[model samples]
Target: MRDVQWIYSHEVVARPQSQQPTARIPAPTSAMQTCGPLLFAACRRRGRPSPADAVCRCLVIHLSARHDGTARRGGSVAATTKPSRLAASPTLPRVPIPTRTRSRMHLHQLKPGEAASLPRHLLEAHVVALVRRCCPGLLALRAAHARLIRLRLPRLTAAFALSKLLASSSSCGAAPSYARNLFDQIPEPTAFCYNSLIRALSSAAGAAPAADTVLVYRRMLRAGSPLPNTFTLAFALKACSIVPALGEGRQLHSQAFRRGLEPSPYVQTGLLNLYAKCEEVALARTVFDGMVGDKNYAAWSAMIGGYSRVGMVNEALGLFREMQAADVNPDEVTMVSVISACAKAGALDLGRWVHAFIDRKGITVDLELSTALIDMYAKCGLIERAKGVFDAMAERDTKAWSAMIVGLAIHGLVEDALKLFSRMLELKVRPNNVTFIGVLSACAHSGLVNEGRRYWSTMQELGIKPSMENYGCMVDLFCRSSLLDEAYSFVTGMAIPPNSVIWRTLLVASKNSNRFDIVQSASKKLLELEPCNPENYVLLSNLYASNSQWDRVSYMRKKMKENNVNVVAGCSSIEINGYLHKFVVSDDSHPEIKEIRLLLREIADRVVRAGHKPWTAAVLHDVGEEEKEVALCEHSERHGSWLPALTGNATTMSTVGVYSTARQIFR
Candidate 1:
């Protein structure tokens, strides 16, 4: 049969035959009219009449003839074709064509039993475009997917189309499981398909989705057809970071190295972030240094944050300086890390400078940055300044409120902390675990045992599970209120095992209350949990010494030697002129150490004259009385306090002011 081109319009117009005027077919019936253009276009594009064409042709003839058995326009049809079984069927449901997509019908001939061999690229492109255009929601996506299945296209074509569908479904709020099922339908899933699913699941909330992302990446690797690319490795590493699947992350790092993707900046950053978050700072730094060129903000931020997490404040600040010298602009994330380091070091002067720098440089002090500033100021003994930052924030989250509340609690403003917590609840802001920690700490500070218990019950009512920190706070509350029996009972009744911190808290309280029996028990538990901790050994040894149990004291010292546990020197930091100066017990390294010691002796004489006696019981060693007094005077906190007084920086005055005021009053 010869091929024919039909131009659809209000009237049916056919291409002219040799020596024949263009034939006009009468209009189709209402039922056929609705589907006429679609059926004719499909048939014409295939270049031959299929069973659908027979139905289309028969419908046209049956509807075009008048009721009197006459052709309305006196038009003669070329052939009278028998209708297929579907010819008399009801009107088919209309498939809405996207307004943006135009029809591209071609008149290509195919042999009998041969399917259309669409250009692979063109077919894939068209199907992908169609899927994206129609899939605005899950329902629309599913409809498009069903239409694709009905077309029975080749496997690769269908896979390409389904890949787009998978991407859309994952993004349009479809569950991760739905995307996984959709991906399984693809016969040979492409790397793009796997990458899309992995990225979506990794970014989704909850552990299960993140785990699914790793599983999908693993399946992609095991399939061995489409190798995991840089994107796949990066996303999988991100999931590992969230899950903290350090073991899996290590395997992916090795895989990246094997695939020569270690050089990729994306892969390097992913590896850096994974290791940084997992607290493998050494590995994170290794990855960071291995990068070929200048590090970006993300790399710098991750490395700095790793240092802050491990309490390596000096390293974090030093790297921040390096980042600045490198001419790299620090983003909010980098500033937050730097601020946190300053908080840990009590570098108040530096923290203030960073805050000013943020304003001077026009960097956005978002909620997170503001919250960090609050924490830094509060920890630096500037609670008022912390409150200023908290109040200045345009919007506050649970973290911001918690930071302020905790700051107040730490500063011994127990009533204020409780008041702010009440305001938070009045505003309907949900309090998280950290908030309760602050609240409980405030209660502990003021010996509000009943209030502490009430808040603990309230936390449970709000579905906020108490973390280890919360449990420790509750134990401290009981101990501080002199509820020794209750504190012990609480520790015994804890749902989770009591850690060394809890045991240490109980031991300190027992020692303070002179309950030697409880002290012995707590000391035993503390030693069992943390035998290498010099503080625990030193604490027990001091108790033994105070009670005149010289043999037990000797035994404690001997056990310390056997365990190779050396006591950690007490250290204190004071910030002056934007510089952090640290001093350790008996430290004489400062250039002005002789002058500081001379001034300290003069102040000690005045304090002693005013009946201020040193508490020599803190010295655990069997030393002379004079030697114990000397050790107390040489403490790091005393040294740190005198330096700020010597510098005349009133902002840093703390213990020094007490000595100065007492001497003046006595004189």
Candidate 2:
């Protein structure tokens, strides 16, 4: 309002030395003239104006000065060599000159709670709007939160801000406890607040058990107000799916149905997934059918996934086909289940078809789906294709690497498997128990005794305890290498009790080596653990006969008959064009038995010509030497190998006829 001297002026005006020659500045601009002293006086009187009002005033002043070509460089005002009209006018009040400190004071120094004259409702509205904009960043949010607490913001406004913080933290992968702490500080959280916390906890994998979601939901229910909505049941059902809590999930379903919320798409999908994950496929199907043609992609996917998880491979494939026929598009989740079903069935053609479909449809090969593809290719005996997919992955997670390593391990590619494991470590990807299992199995299968010991030590160093499967692999490693004493010692010294699988591995190894010293203990332990497994009795019988203990063998046989335990005969299978042909020892059920027998005679003649005599020691029957040799030639496994050769061309003979036998040494 008064003539204020320009701070960046290069010239001084003429004045008396004693008076300091008060510098004459130009009148205030028209825009400032219109506002006059009212805005600044109000702000000065009120301590601080609203941030928005302050910002608006700054923009107006800057734009007005710029339009008049009076803006100067370095944010300084341009000085004019003219007398100020305001200085001569005695009818006006003087306005304070705007400075950096005053501008900042108006913007940031305002205490929100100090605005007492403003209605409480309007203050809370401003805080809510501020929180909505700040929700995307934690730092901005915390700063906002601090300002609110410092100003003692209304409880409702603070609660909403805390709720947003919890939701944002959940999405950003912050610890759920951080949100829990914030939630606890609220005096009384609304249903929205409770739902925010529940949803956050529901999605936090590996942080807490799914049961935590159930507990939070119970707390909400008991709060007696701000009751749950459809979103609440949806998240609760998902948590139940994670825990596979069929009982809790069913209760939620009943509650939702009673409340007329079951028709909600989100709630229905969650319930369907819950029952499916709980392996109640029938219930899941009921949920699906009740929709009466309202099934979405997720509903179909959940049904297919349920069947696949329960090992109903055929049903899964059938449903997948039905899903396609119904014109319902499949997402990555659905294809993952379809690929997994193909893996279980060893349907290589079908797996390839799915892979081609993915490429054709431009579906994203995300980590989970890529892992499933690797597993499918590997299990279908296409390790090369599995490796191709593994190599093509742009980002490999633990699951992808583990699946590839396990695939190689099962295919006897021990070197490749271990190399991949080493590479995974070098890449700083922490190998979990599943990864260790694959590496240990590779070592076991490849007879790498030193490597097995090294890995076992490394596993311990990595703070991974040897699971039952790991222990079994170690036992198998020693057994395969004919170190029976070490194998037995390893089993007995296990930190955890040896499982039936470990005992079976040791028993079979002992029988093969004729190490009867270890047999008695291993057999007793095996029988104790698996009393009804007829294979165990058969193994004991065979072991006794191997040692020429005919009387004991007969006693074992009589006991088996008394127990009505029929042995599971060893069988070998060959896959030809997706059809599997299985053969049991002494089986004559095949229509091509005549040709198979003739091929067997030819193979026996050829083997005799090659100077390889039949080994009859494996014959468990108490018979003469000639009878044993004849039985050996008539073994179904021997016929199984020869049938494919006689039935197919030379190429098929080289590939298809070489079926792996399913015979165990103990049997």
Candidate 3:
């Protein structure tokens, strides 16, 4: 050091852009400055300054990239300089790492080939293990695991301790860390360690697992340990899937495959489960398609469920047929998926065929299967068949009752749904969130303001925390019932957080009930939530126009244009026979264009002769009175009617169905 020369920033006029110095540059100091420009130019001219530039650049790189633990944005090197309290201390290093732990952390703990190779999440999990142990139950388990990690400790003692902790309080916090001295002692894990963790994960199925699971996985991966059996993969896959760690799951899948675990039915199903949760449907299907023989019931069910959720009902039903042709048995899930496909496609005939198949198989109507059947029939216009299914059931769950209630509500049987709701409560099967949504919708449809209000209050009394959907239901319910003040108060005073759906529901409700005073505020919030949702923009403008706020209407319309929120053209469709014939409100695009025009004239003439006035307020257009009236009468449902007509379908009863709401109205 006495023979060596150290240059400070000011002493070095400049430095060349190069890599590290062979010797020390300068010690950390309170004040720091950049090298002079002249020195930089001179250093560039000679290889003499390469070492200095290297050392300087290396110091900056170290500070910016890793020294302070602030992960640098990729590709760009940044230097962070801050004052250290060590500058004033006599014995401490001038550069200090920010840390809060009272005990010293050995640097060798993060040495090469140590647990540092573990995934970042697992490393964080290890950090959590260091902090738990303030509670008595967890304290006991921590001591037991520590003892088990040591020599001469009976495995059963640790097992019993972990079991007692899980059984006593399902909500124990983080795990207790093993001792620092135990790092060098890589003893083989006994059977007890694996068994305890798995049992605890199974018992805590309702909740997510503690991060200890990840830590153990990391340790296993680092050691090239033998793979866990089918049950372990199944459980671990579920835990990983719940956290939605796509990368970790993919790694686990690779390990499973490497260990020849691919064909295991449970493992494959677990793979599908994980993929479906990740919304990687293609992967899930690929795994399902690779099954060697007739798949197990759970495997088939997982595939059907995956397709059903991804809106591929046709494929789901097709797979069901494929399974059936292979002599595989169909269960409630398969039946439910088939019925749901029928409802989505509006295939009433196919739905009836499924019902017959279910009967032939002697499949009894459980609550879920029965509920799906009821919904399929109701949606496909076979209300009578749906009611029959409801009546045939030996027993009903709250969902079954809600299904019927909702079907009746959709068909304008509000009183009927209410009666069934009362029956559900009397049966002592507690109603869930979906059940309340259905019943409240009934109140919305029937304009039962008092009944809807009472139900909203009763939800909290029943100890059910109202969700965002529940509040959306209440807002739309009040809005439909013309209880503007009540709907407004409910949304504004919600204890739980309000969501975009709640705001949008209030906005739409305002338009219907003519509550224009607060429409602007609701519309503003709606735009904030869904700035790119074109419907909200058009609907808000329509709301202003309906309430006679013509000036604000013009401003909103102009703003909507300025923001490029072009309204999608409103096309109406009617289902006639077996076809859907689409008709634009203003343009003629149907193959049956001539007939649609002629029918429109007939409907208009009949309207005038019958003395039924056209309510132009409901029309979502900025046209003149005559044009708006014509648009109102030529809705999509009117065109949909031509669909049935073209397909040789006929309506015996003169019922009118509104296109916008998707509900039929009997005249």
Candidate 4:
């Protein structure tokens, strides 16, 4: 696919006017657009790069069929181009800026706080310095820098004079006004000059700088300047990616194709990356298919990852396997995408296959892959297996330990998780913000109040700052233990603002304790934080029903309908001997419905005999609690579990439930 996109390049870029003798440009005008911006402007000037000793403007960018004239019509030139360290384009000319000095009267004429304004002389240097940080693709700057360039530069003085009026201090970053003034003097800028400006504008952070990159693209187009090279397009694409300007991206890509740039690996990669981010993986694949060769790894990875993220795991795996067959060895990024695909497919057997492959191929298992595997095993109901992998790791980062701890906590092994956390401390593996979340979760899952307090105080003792999630977890732990006022005081005295998740956790804990006022408060806050979340409304209605307020419950239900909130469907999933079966409440969609019903009936009788009562509040949400117990006994996982028990050697086997939480086990 990559090979197909290459354009015939027999000395493609034309030499600048100041160089190769046969040059007749017919002056700059709209007619220049016929030839495209990169070439036309790139063709215009043939001179030494600015600061002749340094290669300031030797760059060539390609856009493919993705980024449009956001540099022109749409107002952006940013693409999130996957940066690669490669030599700069040889044919491109270097920037050769002239010296200039700012007059004292110009300094007097300058507006207050206008120092950062750019000067033409320093424009090439200042922009190079600034953009190299945000986007490092511009290799020309590797040799030159701002402070190294002339400090009393003429362009700097000119920009300084212009900044006295046209610009403000904040507009120029650390660039001086003289550099800003240089921009006006060089009315007929070489592509190097334009590249510098594009680099600076394209790199401006956030939406504001994003908008500026587009304006610059447009200005170049209006000037009948040649389109930017693939490198320039890549930078602009980064901005478009940030703001998600698809139309602008598409236009730039088309312009790139027109400029005969479809073959460049950089352009194709950026196109695929941008398209994937927009949830356009199909389009990204189309771009990937046109890549020239192994040069398009970024493009392939982007498309594969986009598919994997959206749950098209089979397709992602297929592409990766195909890449392998083609001998395109997977890099760390490629492995990350494939590992994610394995997780999404719930393919634990396949995960083992990958692990074996990594071992046989001598591929180092990175922290990311290890973490994904931990999550995969946990989700697959293989907690022991997950632990084995976690313990055997050569080295572990905070996230790796956090993933293992969280996996254990979620699987009803809180003590084991905490024990591993203790090991982490003994090994001097410092915990980050995420470590607290895992620890707090362990406490919540195990109903360990005293242990939670001790660990929490120790957290402060260790100088760890508790984030909002930590606070929520602690509140839920306390509330679940029926420590109502303690939970209340903890939440009210939170150091950070609580979000809806925190409120919802508090509300659920309050519900278990029958704390009506706290429930009301938490629900109110949840509503404010998540106004569109219907669960809060439904839960509040359910809470009123719990207290026997049928009228209030009915009113809440009416409001639900008025606001278009629907009850979330209940779902249960069970993993049995490597196969997962899902059961939705009241759903009879499985193949062996008759057998499932029989197993569920038998489980209900046994659960009741074992003292599992019908749910109370739900029974009167209009039935008797007795009838509700019948309903509880038939809960989805219990039903799903029965099918597994029926298939296994029932009397000899203990049902091991793979749950997202310990409460699920109790349920």
Candidate 5:
């Protein structure tokens, strides 16, 4: 469709000016209406008083004469064969007569100030025509911009024209420096000029950052003229959202409210989004609840998204239900937030229902929505379903591919994840940092040390810096493969200081590998990094006890008591239907706690009968073996792991897998 439109526009440009009707353009038909403005602009471009202006002046006079029947009676007027003004300027193509119908507007109707405005508008239209010939490129725009400046149009005219140039340049993906320089030349910019510049900067790459846009808005305010309108407020809020400036955004919200602009859905939605991105969910909800009359999907979606972004899944879900109750049909944005909440809460059933709703309602599955769906399915432990969603996507972006890869990697489909990564590279889909994290994590988990190194090198070669996650993956890969010394060296060799997680990973792996040298060093570093984290002391004590260093174990326990440190008890949750039920270690808060405990005991007995002895070393307390086994049974993860089987819902398998991983970590 775009190609066809481009061809039509090009055909208008391709027609030579000489080939236009040589006969005097008759009667003010729709096709001839814009000739006056186009000719006037062209004449000005060829110098202030060129012969082209003389010719156009004569043509308009002749047309008026003919219209009033002052010319030869019943006779047609003909253009003279004399050398034409356009003949000297073959480069200026005849302005295509716009085919679209327009309301009657003439140069005569415009006031003195607006007389300059018409020529500038027509000039921009001509420039737009030229830009089409060299579009998706900046050269024509650069030339047009230069010509406009040289013309020295009136101040207001120039600002308007420069604004158009800036917009065109940005739309063509040109370097914004030219536009920025052009904007700086405007002596006193109007509201249109500021709005255009702000909008362009908001969307441009590597241009002024969002913070700069807010500064520009502040400058506009300081100008004290050209008070901001709806457009200005919308763009300003967008800039605030991008920079995530909660204070400035809230201030703007108040200003807009005082100005009575909150009634405008555009301002309302923009303000809601600003609060959402800033993670001020409560304020966003206040804005949402304050909205009067019929609410749009965007306003509701923004509020729900605010909740989802801050990991308040229940609130997001509740809002989704309220939105439905209000008969505000959910759009793609709403669904994305709701699905994300499901992913966070591990609500596979609700996520699936939303997915089906999308299909049933025939909602457009854009890249973002599709990516969210993949993430939801993968995180829900329906990895194959996630892969299916991924494969079926007609247009997959980096996020889509990364979600699938990460999902597969976490679910222990290591080889499958790597294969997809290879395929992604083969298809020339440039992998991002997230993609590398997934691939490297897959390698680390599968003990593909050499493979992990190769990917790390590939990432560097691709100019992708290894982030903390990447470093963690490498350390984990070494540690998992029992290369404690190498892991320690890698940690030391890191360009940035290792976080406690890195040191902790090494400490746990060292104890497993019986590397006392690394265990002591890593534990000391962990304690220093997180002085009050009870896990560090507990881990050190466990290592000492494992090696029968009873005195050192006793000393570590004493230090933990002196510091008043307490371990954060493990907890797990499983989502049934749409509600999440969480269990804490030795939890007795649930009304069904007795039944759950009995069920866990029964499962533990069945496990023993199946010749699967519980790994009890994770119980750090010095207790009898039977007591340690009892402690393992009372663990929250052990109880949560039975939800899928007892509830007869296989969809909660992801919860079980999570429990297994946690159990393995302790083991």
Candidate 6:
């Protein structure tokens, strides 16, 4: 037999088969031999001889000489052959095995059927390199895919590469359909492949794609060859959250429990987000409480955000405090949720404190967080602060611009809102439906009918199909301008069905205009749309009482009783010293109710002395004039207004609406 030299660990040994040690160094396998020339060519192309070049040259020479039968039988090839330069070089650098292996797997040199000769680990590495290089471009990815197919790699190897390609396609702005097609091409795909597709589609832009994410996840469940892992459950749960598939989310929650993946941080957070987003706060809390280990910020943020979404402001604030107690630093997301809750509660002082905390902690205020701050400040009656935050933002997206415009509009800063909108258009910041709502609202507030119409047309021209809120704003615009006929016409002519808010707007405006016919019609539509809304019943009853239709007013009351609809008492909240105090009409629940009542009486007496008269005509009850005045004095907003009097140092107070008597006193 011919003698051969084999690389054994760190050394090259040459010997004939008969004389070889029992513990022989095996000859270079077909993988190394096939890949050797490819590695050598790669080194040459770099125009530099690396340590890999020496290794590859030695491999090629030994393999070639052996196959060509250059060594005669029974002769010592070591004596006949010059020693390999690698063995002779006293200071030869060690070849980086991984580097050489990776270099040989380049897509250009990698051919069909040749990859099969490579070890499984090397083939996987090659597939990873192929994916990374080609994932960014669809055309390049398809080419790499074709090469992968031609090579006919093992199933697991191809699936791994294809799974990566599937995920990258979904995230790199490729259509979900492309990802679906790639997923279909995967033969007996593993849970990893299903997870990759599910994750990509879950975060897709629209509900339809998110639904597809759930579908892919279900397919994984049905296949059942490879059960869903922790990542699979996490991604699938996220899709359920986005689709708001509450039933599916619950099912996944159970699956997590059965699989014992409930303890996984990813799965637990996903469950929390799923329940929280679906408005199932109680269920979400159960899941949250079960997270016994070290909780991350995401878990806390998701829970707090759930409370904020449902307008459970107190709960959200309490959770935020708990998060702080846990020593978890609030990120921008946490702050956004907290600020949103404060806005809902009108907890101005608390909002300010949260803002200060953000600044003190040096948290990065991204666009979403900044927008939330603007909205919170605006709703808290701090328009100037909102404007400051808006101006301070280094970059503004559409939502940021819309938030500022909406804030100004609600605060009745019509000119500023309009000017800001104009600037937004000038800066090429495309206005969405929300932006038009603010524009139309500003016009409605100022009774600028022409400007409202102009902006409405501009919004349509920008291809922004009007949403329900946008249509509501336009209806309000016409109604506030005393164009009751136009408002009615606009509602009837809307492409989409007018919701209760639009009818309610028309009803209020018509009642204020004393157009009983319009009020009757609007109220009928509003009641039909939202039969349980006590405000609609009260408004209609008040309209009847104004016309001395006592029997009709009684009928309305009877209808409310029959429907079990109780009037929602007017409620207002004021924040002082970081505590939120709420007051309803004649509320006696406050711990300092006596002090508030005493201060209120004093303020009322002073306002009466100042020649202020309470407007009791709007009172719906058919009572004596003195009783109407008393009822007006006992209004919820009037009760809220006395908070500053009780707290002496309170600079700002917010109320739903105060009686004329209270308004003058508070101002």
The lDDT leader among the candidates is 6
Model 2 TM-score, all chains together: 0.69
Question: Local distance difference test, per candidate?
Answer: 0.77, 0.73, 0.62, 0.62, 0.73, 0.77
560-652 per-residue lDDT for model 1 (tens digits):
999999987766666667666767666788776677788888988899999999788888779999998887778666676777667777564
Tens digits of per-residue lDDT for model 2 on 1-667? 1222322111223335585546554544676645533554444454444443343334334334424322221121111111212111122222333343233332344475564554555555555555666666767777766776777655665666577666666565556787788889878887777777877777677635367777887787788777778898888888778767777788788889888989888898998899888888888888887874457899999999998888666678888888888898899999999998777655566678889999998888899999999998887677899999999999999999999999999888999999999999999998888898899999989899999999999999999877898888889899999999999999999898887789888988988898877888988898788777887787788778888889989988788888788887766654455444567777788787778877777777799899998888888889998888778877766665565567664354323332334431111
- Where model 6 places Cα greater than 4 Å from the true spot, the runs are 1-101, 136-140, 150-156, 209-214, 602-613, 651-667
Give me the overall lDDT of model 2.
0.73
List, in order, the clash count of every candidate structure.
0, 0, 13, 79, 0, 0
Q: For candidate 5, write residues 1-667 as lDDT tens digits.
A: 5744443333334566776546544555544444655555554444444443444544454444435432211111122222243332333223323311110122112233443545555544543454454455677777766665555557656666666776676567665466577678777777887887777676655424466677777788899988888888898788778767777777778878887888777887888899899898877887788777788898888888889898777788888888889988888888999999888767777788889989998888899999999998887778889988888999888999899999999888998999999999999998899998899899988899999999999999999888898899999999989888888999999999999999999988988877878877888888889989877887778778877778898898788789988777777666666676677876698665677678878888999999998888777777899998888778776566665566677563444433222442111
By lDDT rank, best first, the candidates go: 6, 1, 2, 5, 4, 3
Q: Which ten residues in a row have the lowest lDDT in candidate 4?
A: 73-82
Over the stretch 186-239, how does candidate 6's per-residue lDDT look in tens digits? 887877778878877776777664557667767777887788889988988888
lDDT measured at residue 8 in model 2 versus the true structure, 0 to 100: 13
Model 4 — TM-score against the truth?
Answer: 0.60
Q: Write the per-residue lDDT of candidate 3 for residues 1-667, one digit (tens) a residue.
A: 3222343332333445463356554543322222322333343345244445433433432334323322221111112111111111122123432232111121113333444334444333333343234244656555634533442323333333344333323234433232211221324543334434543453344334424455556665576554466666666677766766677678779878987887888789889888876768899999988977767877777787777767555677678788888788888877887777666655565677789999999976688899999998787666788899999989888778778887887787888888888888887879888778887888888788789889877787899888777788788877776778887888889988677778877777676665667676787788887787777766767676766767877887787778888777765433333233455656666677767667777878898899888888777566798987777656766665554554455564233222333344322
Better of 1 and 2 by TM-score: 1
Candidate 4 residues lying further than 4 Å off, grouped into runs, are: 1-224, 239-272, 275-300, 307-329, 341-347, 378-384, 408-430, 443-466, 574-582, 586-589, 593-595, 602-635, 642-667
Assess the local accuracy of residue 224 in candidate 4 as a C-alpha lDDT between 0 and 100. 78
Tell me the tens digit of each residue's lDDT in model 4 across 1-667.
2322212121234556576435432433443333344442332232222221111111112321223322321111111111223233455333222222122222223333343464454444443333333332323232222332334345544343322222222233423223334455554665555555655554455555455666767777788776577776776676677667788788778878888876778778878887877778778888888788664466667877888778666678778788778777666677777777766655555566776777787766788878877877776567888888887888889889988888888777888889989999999998876787788888987799988999899889889898877887898888778888898888889898888877787788777877779988888788778766777776777777777888888987887788787776566555444444666767889775568777666766787799985455554466665667667655666766666556763554344552322234412
Q: What is the lDDT of candidate 6?
A: 0.77
TM of each candidate vs. truth: 0.75, 0.69, 0.61, 0.60, 0.73, 0.81
